[model samples]
Target: MLLSACSSAERGPVIPFFGAYFPSWIACSLIGVFGAVIIRLLFIKAGIDAVMPLRVIVYLFLAIAIGLLSSILLFGR
Candidate 1:
């Protein structure tokens, strides 16, 4: 049974770009980081960042959420 679970078809999704293969999650994570930076810039422009509590944690989770959502939506992973 364990052997059956190890089929080659079960390999996780990867993206091919520029003659290199990268795991889809890596792309999603980069997008998330970019999104977080843009969001922070917007927040600063609107003067909202200073009012938020635990700003680091909020941004960290925002990046993580963006990464996971993009991963699911873009790669179906």
Candidate 2:
């Protein structure tokens, strides 16, 4: 299937830098955190951010979502 082809069976991609290896997930998750910041900014602009009783939870959720999406897109399933 299309998904099977795209999905990786082994560990996800890794970045080699100066003889060190870093999992790609870390990079994507950081990007996701940045994305969460942008999303929070947008919510603030829309005045919806004020309504959230738990802003941290919402932001964390957004970050996790973005990270997963990035991982899927970059590495595969």
Candidate 3:
């Protein structure tokens, strides 16, 4: 029971759209996914995608990084 006190009481950032509150993380993640898709297209056009050994992991990390970075910058969390 004492460990529960260590948790933060502040609510996470949210966005209101169409009369509903949406968690900011979801928006950030969607942005990241779209960004990754665009990046992948760019990489393919530049002939960089073929050189990558682990494309899946690379894109996954890129998405997460973009998501977190956008979240921090946009939400200040």
Per-residue C-alpha lDDT of model 2 across residues 1-77, encoded as one tens digit per residue: 75785666755589887999998988899989999999999999999999988999989999999999998998885
Q: State the lDDT at 13 in candidate 3.
A: 82
Lowest summed lDDT window (length 10), candidate 1: 1-10
Over the full model, what C-alpha lDDT does candidate 2 score relative to the true structure?
0.89
What is candidate 2's CA lDDT for residue 8?
63
**Model 3 per-residue lDDT tens digits across residues 1-77:** 87776677756788999999999999999999999999999999999999999999999999999999999999997
Identify the candidate with maximal TM-score. Answer: 1
Ranking by lDDT: 3, 1, 2
lDDT for residue 64 in candidate 2, whole number 0-100:
96
The TM-scores, one per candidate, come to: 0.90, 0.75, 0.85
Q: Which pairs clash in model 3?
A: none
> Which stretches in model 3 have alpha-carbon errors above 4 Å?
1-9
Stretches of model 2 off by over 4 angstroms after superposition? 1-11, 17-20
| RMSD to true structure for each model, in Å | 1.2, 6.0, 3.0
Q: What lDDT would each prediction earn against the true structure?
A: 0.92, 0.89, 0.93
For candidate 3, the lDDT comes to 0.93
